[model samples]
Target: MAGFLELIDNTLGTHFHTPVYDPQTGRKKILRVIELASKQHNEGTTRAPNRSWAAGNNEGISFSPKIDGKPVLIGGKETNFVHKSRFQDFLKGLKAAVEKGDLDKEIKAALDGDAAPRASTSSSSGTRSGRNPLSNVRSSIGRSLGNGKSLEEAEATARANPKFDAAHIDQVVAEAKANAK
Candidate 1:
């Protein structure tokens, strides 16, 4: 059920709308809100942006059933209007649809073909392994100061790296001076 929900989320975003076209008139018509579980609509946790399923409110896990820009009838009443206790039933229905391969093939293909977003970095190899670049530079500056290389040479080494800004260089220099004692 979780896997099916994840696949659906990756294909069609949590907050997205689809445009309904008039087949007889052959023109684009109403914009229908498909799946809406917005954070702004529900009160959230202090740490999290929205109410999680495990936290009692199923707003995060609930997915609405819409047809012709309106809620579909599940048990004589609109599915969205139903009480929150029936959220498990809604998830089961969604899982069944996924198992029957009711999702659009084109959307699945597009999602599968796209690459994941890359992390931003100055180094050619992008690895943020919890090491501060400034600290490394500072250590190198301290080493240089210990090796009898003048303060100017240590500053030059710090300046050569594009990652080290003016403030970073100053911090490194101050650390190097402190380490000399």
Candidate 2:
């Protein structure tokens, strides 16, 4: 299972950081939906440097877990997956749903990294910034993904990009996948 998780993370660059088995009890963590999402893609970076607004604020809503062997939960509220075997499959389904555009507004927003509340801009604002918000992030992920270079070459190129991190590359890919559809 650990090898499988590592393979997924390496190939797709995703952060499925949930501890499926406890260290002491050897059982999955008692996780709520929000806790799950936060672990996968928690908020830290912001759209603007000075602003507090960030993306993925409503990320919790995307966690659609099947409990008690049914794809249903009451009140659209919190729940858990008690059965250990179900989590891996559930994550695969969630990824498929995002890839297929079967997502709620909040999840869509979180996926796009644009769900954070925005401050009002001046009505007279006319100047266009030359920078694309995702250029650096895209480049970083690209470098980590090999960028047409051999594995060894890609590893070397990855070091040149300061924004690159293994888990972060995963999150970026996940966000890109969400936005692609």
Per-model TM-score versus the true fold: 0.28, 0.20
What do the candidate models score in CA lDDT, each in turn? 0.45, 0.39
Clashing pairs in 1: none
lDDT of 1 by residue, 43-150 (tens): 432233222223225333333333333333333332234245554455556444534544333223223322122243345432233456666677767767767889
Highest TM-score: give the candidate number.
1
| Tens-place lDDT digits, model 2, residues 14-118 | 546733432222112112332344344344322322221123333322333332222223234323332333434655565455444444433433334344333
Number of clashes found in candidate 1:
0
- Tell me how candidate 2 scores on lDDT: 0.39
Top candidate on lDDT is 1
